[model samples]
Structure formats: structure tokens, C-alpha cells
Target: MAKLGAPPMPWQKYVSDVALEIDPDTGLFAHREVGLSVSRQQGKTELTLGAQVHRALAWPRQNIVYAAQTRGMARQRWEDEFWEKISSSDLAKMARIRKSNGNEAILWGRTRSRMGITANTEKAGHGPPLDLGFIDEAFAHEDDRLEQAFSPAMLTRAMAQLWWASAGGTTKSVWLNKKRENGRRLVEALWEALAVDLSAPRPRACYFEWFAPDDMDRADPATWRATLPALGFTVTEEVIAAELEKMDPAEFDRAYLNRTRRPTPPTDPNVPKGKWPGLLDAASKPVASSVALAIDVSQDRNRSAISAASLRPDGRVHLEVVAYRPGTDWVVPAVARLHRLWKPVAVAVASGSPAASLIDDLVTAGIDVPKDKANPERGDLAVMRSGDVTEACGQLADAMNQGTVRHLDQVPLTAAVNGARTRRQGDAWTLDRTNSLVDISPLCAATWARWALVIRGPHVIEDYDIADSFA
Candidate 1:
């Protein structure tokens, strides 16, 4: 079999060094466990693909697996783009390409290496031992089941090289969330119970997590460039200034800056979209028999907002927000005004932190507050009621996609929505700490809790369908 050649690109060379340091004999890296937390578009794909080709050429009779979160993503990224580059390259032909079943099974005879891709389904990933494996977008797969299920096959090929690459997800899971949460709790419990768990080192396992050095500097493109040294991809001041002018703040945060933000609300493009036509004007007419007020609080000191979401008997909900500046305690008085003006049937305040305090103060002051707790269970209900986050994000994405959810319509609220990031914890979800966007949940929770007032027509009932739905 012909030997595989070294990579020519700088990025490839760096990865080559890493591979050689791990498995020098085969000039291939089989990471028993390795994590690559890289910034977006930093040539992760290029390096990985180059490495795959080099390994296949250098090591004959080897099996390689490439995988991603979804089949479509896997096909487009690895099988389509990366595979094309490898097969078209002179190096690929040098190794001799043989295919069976329309390239499903590819054999490079000169190097005795074969490569195949499997969709990220349980059935698709089932296979015999593999000499090398690749996982893309590992962050997108929160459950870790993919790693658990797929790694066994690769491990059976004990002599093979295994590499797991991903842009590590935001910290909100049981494993990676803040140390105060489940991850830390688990460590405490295990140490107390077994005592030896922490001290002992397990064979064939090494854990390494690499994050950007300055977590606080995510907004700077130079910070991103530092994570990706091989690309020669620098965010020049001119390019950044131009981007800031053209892209919305949300897009800038998510796409270029990698900042997590609030999701855009979806809208139907076929409908003629315009201003809400002065929600207060509609409210002044006293057309509605009852009102449901949902109030969301701010974690940061700068902004506190209350959104009045009125639900008519017809089942359509209307939203009008009255936001306030930091250090201003307007939530209770606002509720008072809402009560006197709209005669809202129920008031709901998010049930935690300053919000919960506000709810208590309102109740003590004789302003009735139905339970306004932001129950994780309620968020789950929202998911079930509206389907997945992707489905909900569709409308927000649509308005952005269709040019309908614009700045002119509601600039402040839209901007707030753009700064949120969500991660699923064990049976719960959380907003990213770095995100400064306002949360609608406290208000939504208050609104959901006030549904009882809706049915009773402004009368406070201790219990209602909304409360019971999650109870």
C-alpha cells in the first residue's frame, strides 16, 4: 500500500502535529477522547477533512466514519463538500479510489483505507469496528447519547485513531452548567459516596475542554481569530465597521460575534404585516371583557419590562409592552395602573427573585396576583403547546427571513429578543448567563397563571386550568 502524504496547509500541519503527537506510527490520531472547541468558520472542517484524507492514504485497510447532528448536515458538509475535495485532489487518486453501491463504500487501494458516512440516526450509526471516526457539531447533540452509542464501535477498533471534534455548547446542561448546578452536585455526591472516584484515574480516557481564553471578550473578532490561529482570518476594523452598519445587532451577535440572543418571533409572510395599530387605542375603547397581564423582570440592572398580553375569549392573544429603565421599581405600580385602566381579571408575576418579591408585595398591598412563577414545567408546556424551539423560532426567523420583523415596528423589544441563548438542562432549560436580553417567561408565566381570571372575568380564583395544566 502507498503511504499517505503529509498535509500542506498550515491548519492541516497543526492538526498533523497533534495527530503525530498522539499516534505517530500511523501518522494518524485516534483520540480515545479529545474535544476541539473552535470558533465558527475557523477551518475546523478543512483541517478535519485534510486529516481524514491523509489518514486514509497512509493507513491501508482502515475504516473511517464521519457523522453530524443530522443526516442532511452530515451529507452536505462531510460527504458532499469534504468528500468532493478529497476525491478530486491528486492525493486521492494517488491512493486509488474504488467504490461499491454508488460510493457508499469507498476503498483507496494504494493506501488500503476506506471511508463511509452514516446519518446520525440510531440505525445509521450501527456498524462494525472503525479505525477512525469524526463527530461534527457535537454541541447540537445535548443528550450525549450519540457519543455513548457510537464510541463503542470505534473503540472495538482499539488500534484505530478516534477524534471527537465539536464547538462545545453553551453551559446549561447537567454536565457543563455552572459548578453550583448538577455537574458540581454530582461530583460532591460521588466523592462523598465512593471517595475514590475523584482520586482514581480511569484507563483509556482523558478529558480536555478548551474555551476561548477571555470569555468576556467574545464580542471582539480578534478573540475569535485567536482561537483559530491557522486561518489567517482576521476581523479587520474596516470589515467589522462595515458589518456593524449592515447587519442588525442580533445578527451581528449570533453570526459574526457568536453571542447568544433572544430568538426572533415567526410571522406568516402571506399576511399583510404592519404596526399593531396602537394597542392602547384599542384598549381605550374598553372592548375586551377581561385582560391578562404578563410581566417579565430583568436580571441585569439596566432594563425592566412589563408586557401586557391580553387574551380575548376568541383565543387570540395581544401583546403590548411597557418597559422601564434600571433602578426603577415600576412593576407594582404598573400593575395598579393596569388594574384600574384595563381592570385586568388577573395579574401574574414571574415567581422568582425580584419578580417573586414583587408578586408578594403586590398581594400584600391588596393588588391580587395570581401565581406568576416561571415554572420550568411551564416552559415544557410551551414546547409541547407550540412544538420545539425550532418551530417557535420559525416565526421569528421568518420575519427576519421575510423582512417583516423589522426595527421600525418595535425596535427595543426586538433588540431585547435578539440577545438570548437557551440550553436544555435535565428536564429543564435556562438562558445563558452572558446573554443580556430580556426574558418574556416571567410575563408569560404571569399571563399563563392569569388564565383563570380570564374564565372568571377579572375575579381571582385560587386555582385554574393554567395552574392545573402544569401542576
Candidate 2:
């Protein structure tokens, strides 16, 4: 903080105090993992840099790694922020900066310790005995691949510490969401134990979160201070108000108030609120039931997703995305391969849609597809009209609302559901690709699959039908 010309906020001080707690017997940090969830631009980076400086100075030959979502971001933090701070401080005389091959480091000559900054990739945080690992923008990490790679580097250092700090992300943030949930559970447990007795054991991990209540008014000044510790100092209420005017309310809530925007039922009566979550089935698994395949391509045709809908034994519809990839070239082959293996009752595709261009290719591959919807028995393919698309979207929404459909809780699908918007076509409504903030291809695919499953009832699948013919 000294390098940044600032004092630690009260919340930052509290977090630091807990994170630096020592196990007297072992002479190591009590908490090996420390997590911080706060609003953006609240001096988190500064605090982390100060911690890195302290570790570099206190521990001789300590190896510290600072990781971000991208290499450019990591380098900016070190060069633009950390370097400026160190240059302005007395530590400048003791530190040496080096850059090479997309990697940068700061070496403390006196202690023989160094700090490295890079993007979080599969190969990052390796080849060093790490004493400290700082993961910035933790919410952007959708999986644990980078964390898994970095964990082994700390195994040899008994005093190693790992830190994760970020603002709340969307529903698809699997890793960050898990960390927040675990932290909340631990905090709740600790409070309950403290209510009964004073000498209760606390959780070993530090989970620090500062957020406003869900019901709080976002426009109120009190709410700003309650969530943003730097509101009065580094940032002012006037500046935030000006920003609020330019930003979306939901985005402002997530970035400044540290809140997750709950999905509300659209006033246009598209998808009902709370219907998606009610349909989640954790125990849902793939079975031998008759399946229908639906493929959806993004508006830009840069990405496509294929989904399967099947009728479970309990008579409930189950949907899942089987494949998602970049570019449209992989759509035909992938669908054909899945068709040969699964032998789906029908492959649904919308006419005049982005995916419609692949119907000819599918037919050329010796796959039977309906050339026209007028003849129902033309082939295994189901050609959908604009009216069919609207009806399918409505059916899927109604099924979820009535608990007649179940899903495996796929992250991409969940994200699409949360961000999807609706637009009216004549008298019917469909997902609005032009206005949707996130990709809804998964939801679109599921809708077509559901419609196909309804049109084609259950079919008996013989063991021989599962032959691997798509070599």
C-alpha cells in the first residue's frame, strides 16, 4: 500500500490480519488458501502487490507467482502498476526487473527471492518451489485446470500460501461460485459455533466477502459505502453515479455492488422466472431412451452447439449439449457421427436459419433429411418453420415451468438461460439473438430437440442399433 500511496481499507486490513494468522507450533500460515470477493477497483491489486513485496523481503529465496486470466493482464499489473509502485519506493534499490519470452519477473537481490507474473495456463506455476501464488480475476476461471497445475509447485514449501481475489461473476463461473459457496458455509458454521461457545475452532481458510444485501437500493449512497470500501477515498459517490448512468443496471450491480443479478420472469411472458432452476436434476444421466438431436449455429456462424433431448423412464424430458465448437465446418460430420451412434429419432433443423446451410451437406453424406416439412415421413430430419421455432421455444419454457423437463445442469446452458432475451415475430416469440448479451445456442438447440421428441414418441432401440459405423 505504501508503494501505491494509499492506506489499507478497513476490510482489507481485516482480511490481511486473518490471512497472515500463524500456526504457532508449525510456524506457518494458519490458512493456506485465502479468498477475497469484492467490487471492482477497490484496491485489491494494490493490497496483493503489498503482500508480495512483504513476502519477497521477509523470506529469503521465496518464489512468488502472480497469475491473471491473460498474459497481457498479468504483464500490465507488473509493468504498469507494480513497477511504478516499486520505483517510487525505497525497495527500488533492491529489486531488479527482467522480461523474456512473454514472461516477466522481479528479483530481490538482497534476499535472493523473486516474483514472477504470467497468465494462468496449463503450464503455468510449474518448475519452481512456490511460496506464494496470487490468482487475480478468479471469477474468470471457469475450471480448475490452472489451479491444479499450480498446486504441485507449493507442495514442497511448508509455508506456501495461495490467494484468489475477484468480483462476483455470472452463473457459469463454476470455480468462483464453488469458492463463494464454501466460504459462506464455513462462515455460517463458525457463527453458529461461536453462539454456543467462545472457544470454537475456526475454519483454516480465509474467505473475505463484502457485498450489499439483495434488497438494498443501488442508487442509495449508503449502499455504495456498504459494498465499496474505497467509495470515499479512491473512488467517490459522484464518480460512481456518473458511471451508473452509462452502465447497464445489472452489470453495475455485479461490478460495483458485488451482487449476482437474479433472473426475473420477462414481462413479455417468454420464459417464466425460477422455471430453469426448478428443472435442474442432479441425478439425471444419459440412458438408452430414444433421443432427438438439434443443432444451433451462432449469428456470426463462428460457433455451433448440438443438443440431445430424450424421454427418461419417468416420462420427464431430459436435455443436454453433446457437442459445442468453433466454426461451422464441424457441424455436418459431428451430427452425422452422432446420428450413426445414437440413431436419434429425428434431426431437427430450422429452415432459413444459420444452421440450415448444412442440410445439403448432411444429405450429401447419405443422411436422410426432410426437404420439405409438408411431407412428415420424408426422412429422419425435421425441418422447422418460423412458427415451429416459436412453438418449440414456448413448449420448452412451459415444460420447465411445469417441472416436466429436467436438465443435467450444464454450465453453458445455464448461462444461456440467464442471459437470453425474447423477441416477437408476428404473434409468436423466440430467442432474440440480436439483443442477447450471451450466446443462447445451447438453449436454442435444446428447444429444437424438445420439439422433435414431442413429435416423435419413444422408439425401441435394439443392441445392434448402437454399432460404431462412423469410422
Q: Give the TM-score of candidate 2.
A: 0.58
Candidate number achieving the greatest lDDT relative to the actual structure: 2
Q: What's the C-alpha lDDT at position 278 in model 1? A: 24
Minimal lDDT window, size 10, model 2: 462-471
**TM-score of each model, paired residue for residue:** 0.45, 0.58
lDDT of each: 0.47, 0.81
* Candidate 2 Cα outliers beyond 4 Å, as residue runs: 261-471
lDDT of 1 by residue, 70-169 (tens): 7667766755676566666665655433434334645677766777776655554466677677777765554655555566777656556556555434
Candidate 2 lDDT over 73-93, as tens digits, reads 888888888888887787789
